[model samples]
Target: MIRARHAGVAAGAAVLLLLTACGSHGDNTQSPAPASSTDLTHLQKLVEDAESAASSAESDMARE
Candidate 1:
């Protein structure tokens, strides 16, 4: 399980790396900054919602 999880993560990272290395030939003058606190906060909210959904699903399954 651990190996599978690691492999999955590695595969995702490889994809991201490939995309980054093969940059677009267009102008990047309007690109957003790499890191932003607002983005982090939004991601945190998304994670919370996902966890809540998972918990709700588990409870639903338990009652079935």
Candidate 2:
């Protein structure tokens, strides 16, 4: 009976340790940088140019 009680206490302690190990203790409250209108416009232009270049490359590869 005492052995069983000891085993049960050990099992409970193991479970508590596992739960504490799995918990996130770091600060994750940082906010993201807000994007401005000009930044969005620039990013959009860059994406458009990249897409145009990719399409041209694909067409050239098909012709080869």
Q: Number of the top candidate by TM-score?
A: 2
Worst 10 residues of 1 by lDDT: 1-10
Clashes by residue pair, model 2: none
Q: How well does candidate 2 score on lDDT at residue 39? A: 56
**Candidate 1 ranges with C-alpha deviation above 4 Å:** 1-34
lDDT of each: 0.54, 0.54
Each model's TM-score, in the order given? 0.48, 0.51
Could you tell me how far off, in angstroms, the CA of residue 13 lies in candidate 2 after the best superposition?
A: 50
lDDT measured at residue 4 in model 1 versus the true structure, 0 to 100: 48
- lDDT string, candidate 2, 1-64, tens digits: 4344444555555554444435544578354445556755655565565555556666666787
lDDT of predicted model 2: 0.54
lDDT of 1 by residue, 1-64 (tens): 4344444555555555445445454676455335355655655565565555556666666787
Clashes of 1: 0
What stretches of model 2 exceed 4 Å from their correct place? 1-29
